[model samples]
Target: MIFVNILISFIVIIILQLLGMVILSKMTPFNDMEELNKGNVAVGLVFGGQFLGTAIILGVAAYTNSSIWYMALWFAVGYVCLLLSYWIFDWLTPGIKLSDQLKDGNKAVALLLACVYIGIGFAVSSLII
Candidate 1:
């Protein structure tokens, strides 16, 4: 049963990560893969953060929950929180559009956002148990 739970978690986590990527891509106006392929460091930073953030949440959820379904449920909560943090940060900052700055390769904004995502992941993970 433990092995089965682990296997299910592995599959579900991968699916969740893909879903997060899709949602993120839809949020931005530019093509995510195109930017990454073009060697855009700003996009790389933010995108990397998004990936790591979800990973952190998933790991914590899996660790805390005994059942696979419960783990996925907790993951959903953390994932929603993470997404909210992203949108809230963007909304709070006026004058400049983060998506545009990212496309233009603004490392400063990218770095800040990356840290935000990572930080939120850790913060949310702590509350999981």
Candidate 2:
């Protein structure tokens, strides 16, 4: 059933994105949801960045694969690359922990990180085809 495939893909993508966010939360020094509840714009920017990045990759995965399983598998691959990009970003920054800065509500770092994530997402997605 085509509708069933669509439903499965939708569910799988939702789960994968949530899992990616959960893993990112674990890597952070603060609770993202709590910060959002506290009106932390910096945290909001970073989350938006990561979400955009993952969405781009997911879009590409879905476009390139006909089978739902292949789509899900490729999405997982892209998601892993997204996670690695964050770590690489952390290592690349000079003498500052990116996550800590975000927790401290640094808007500049948050914006920069967000832009970097978006750019990386585009870059990674471009490679998927």
Q: Best lDDT goes to which candidate?
A: 1
Clashes of each: 0, 0
lDDT of 2 by residue, 13-116 (tens): 88977887887788787898898899889989988888888888888878887766766676677667767877888899878798888888999988888888
lDDT of 1 by residue, 1-129 (tens): 768867877898899889888888778899988998999999999988988888898888887776667767766777788789878998999877889999999999999998898898899888887
TM-score of each: 0.90, 0.88
Instruction: Please list the C-alpha lDDT of all candidates, in the order they appear.
Output: 0.85, 0.82
Q: CA shift at 37, candidate 2, in angstroms?
A: 1.4
Candidate 2 off by > 4 Å: none
In model 1, what is the error at residue 93, expressed in angstroms? 1.5
